[model samples]
Target: MLTQEPIYPKPFLKWAGGKTKLIQQYISLFPQKIINYYEPFLGGGAVFFYLYNHYFLSSAFLSDINPELINTYLCIKHDVEAVISLLQQHQANHNQEYYYYMRSYNTENSVERAARLIYLNKTCFNGLYRENSKGEFNVPMGKYKNPQICNPEVLRAVAKALQVAQIEVKPFETVLNYAKSSEDFVYFDPPYHPLSETSNFTAYSRDSFNKDDQIRLKNVCVELAQRGVKLIQSNSDCPFIRELYKDFKIYEIQAARAINSNASKRGKISEVLITI
Candidate 1:
């Protein structure tokens, strides 16, 4: 019997700092071949999904600091049908009140939580994931006339893609435990340093990624570089960041920004891609 081929899956959720647009421009910076792929801050996982679909990945290790997001990935990887079924129910009952209700809903069921997150992400304002000091998801409802709440094809595709990946909820530095020297590629897309005082939106979890965290990441990059691990990292083009990774090769590129609340602030902005 002939089996159906897995469809190429794009990012399932709309992330604030998603790299979907820059994947093309940054394509040249990606390693030609990867034995193992490591993404520590796997927001929306655009680059990981893209590379996996394109057959550029042999094995992958994906991790993030957010427990909810990691749980969603785990649900999809282990029981996509259950997640999709719950999403279908959500699609049938979607409304402003329903959105708010689901946003505040807490559940121990992995499938339900995953479905709820996908629902909120699809229907939330700008598809941005923001958490309050208490670690509660607080983004309000979006104004999309009609949102795609349940797409079975996309969910199935995502499930297929995640089969080869080992997803985890861990600190970025833990990648050192799994990655082998000279045989792995690690892509770091941590929260970018705030461009200005008002542009800070790094709170995907209750914990904030401050300047010290940035420095720690740079130190990890330095250690990985010395160990012969290939690395690619993206962050805001700022003096602090430049000095942080001064020993590596940095390339500045313009990436469009649409997550800003102010219309005037939404435009192309300079970002840096550091390689080692």
Candidate 2:
């Protein structure tokens, strides 16, 4: 039998609120055994990759409402070589002019779109995948001296880790249709409710996550818990979030502010990890 390299797979995309840094804090929190794993807000998927590396999954179901994000994951899972080929070309032809052009470029090809997103993500300002109100990706290019636009090794490793996974573009609530048993483990990393008005950073796509959505998510969590599906959810450590998940066992998570344009704004903050 073949084996993956010693290097564990990592999330290919640089996503806001990515859980990579906080995985250590989350390590002890995961159940000793997880048969089937579900992550609805599959952002950078740091948690999923870590769980996969530990051989904790019988099968994995990852979904996100962002179609481009899902397409990139799918392309990597199904056709990583093609995506890597395009990425190498992008890396070879990379420049400020090329970056701007690709940011505006649109295509129907799934692989091309996947490669495009990965390329832009590696080079974009702060690696943010935000969009304008008109639905166009609008983040300016970053000033990375030499960005690794194409990482074939990482891509291939991610593909291997995703072999036992089902990737989809769907709403978060849809996890109810599949994860209905105690054997299922569901992790929710939703767009966190804002801590303040000036810090409204929940915009992963055209739509911003609001208080109502957070409430709806809690309702879904309640239903899932009632059904005996083991669940863990992450959210901002704010009054509203605490009040929303008041019924569950919420733990305060110490996490660094992962992203901010201002260097001073990047500091340690509190978050919550709710479990049932």
* Prediction RMSDs, each to the true structure: 2.3, 2.1
Q: After superposition, how far is residue 190 of candidate 2 from its true place, in Å?
A: 0.6
The C-alpha stretches of model 2 lying farther than 4 A from their native spots are 1-5
Task: Write the residue-wise lDDT of candidate 2 on 1-276 in tens digits.
Answer: 899647678998888999988999998888888899999999999999999988556599999998999999999999999999999999999999999999999999999999999999999998998998888999999999999998899899999888889999999999999999898899999998999998888986898889999989999999999999999999999999888888899999899986876789899999999998
Regions of model 1 farther than 4 Å from truth: 1-6
Best by TM-score: 2
In angstroms, the error of model 2 at 205 is 1.2
Against the reference, the lDDT scores of all candidates come to: 0.90, 0.91
Candidate 1: tens digits of C-alpha lDDT, residues 1-276: 999875678899999899998988788988777889999999899999989977557699999989989999999999999999999999999999999999999888888989999999999999988888887899999998889998899888888889999999999999888776888899999999987788887866688899999999998998899899999999999888988888899999999999777899889999999998
Q: Which ten residues in a row are the worst by lDDT in model 1?
A: 49-58
